[model samples]
Target: MIFGTCGQRAPSVGESAPAERRKYIEEHFRCISDCDMCGICAVYHNQDPLLVYRDYIEGTRTFEEITEEYRR
Candidate 1:
């Protein structure tokens, strides 16, 4: 999978990502500068970060709710 500045795996040719994923990509992934200082894209290389934040993004769970689960 080709990883892009969007900090997620890029959709293949002719394939489209879900609206939520696209929104996240557009809002959070698009780099503002030439510096690749943020390592978030690298995290996507190993796993789908979206899965971890799905609940938070979908409004089903608050940030604290999801983070609390991991804190345990």
Candidate 2:
């Protein structure tokens, strides 16, 4: 099984994520500059950094989407 950013297997493309997991990720992750704890492109969408990275790698999501939705 392929584990996703959230430490669990990822769902197929276009599949909706679980609400609870999504909520947890939202509460815990934040995209910001001037920080380098994990060293991954996670400065948009206010989504889980790991998830963002995973999505990016999988080609399911794009940097543009993150910028358009979360970047201020």
Candidate 3:
């Protein structure tokens, strides 16, 4: 898949989207540096913490599912 950012050329086909996104996050995303290992970011961000950090994955969960309890 081709990964892209605004004003940037799309990654060549056959590149890994997860790997590309992971690299971008590591270099530019600041909260990752001081993350307390708390699970809140997962719920708040609607992503799975383990998949995101350990496996460099994204879009594993949704806002409705993460905040389901609070909406009860």
The TM-scores of all predictions, comma-separated, are 0.35, 0.28, 0.25
lDDT tens readout by residue for model 2, 1-72: 444335644343455455533543444454446456643354543455656545533546643454345445
Maximum-lDDT candidate: 1
Q: What do the candidate models score in CA lDDT, each in turn?
A: 0.50, 0.46, 0.40
lDDT of predicted model 1: 0.50
Give the CA lDDT, 0 to 100, for residue 26 in model 3: 46
Query: How do all the candidates rank in terms of TM-score, highest first?
Result: 1, 2, 3
Better candidate number, 1 or 3, judged by lDDT:
1
Ranking according to lDDT, highest score first? 1, 2, 3
* Model 1 regions lying over 4 Å from their true place: 1-47
Superposed on all Cα atoms, the candidates' RMSDs to the truth, in angstroms, are: 10.8, 8.5, 8.7
lDDT of 3: 0.40
Candidate 3, residues 1-72, lDDT tens digits: the string is 222223343222234465664555444333443457634454437554334443333534332243353334
Which ten contiguous residues of candidate 1 have the minimum total lDDT?
9-18
Superposition-based RMSD of candidate 3 using all C-alpha atoms, in angstroms: 8.7
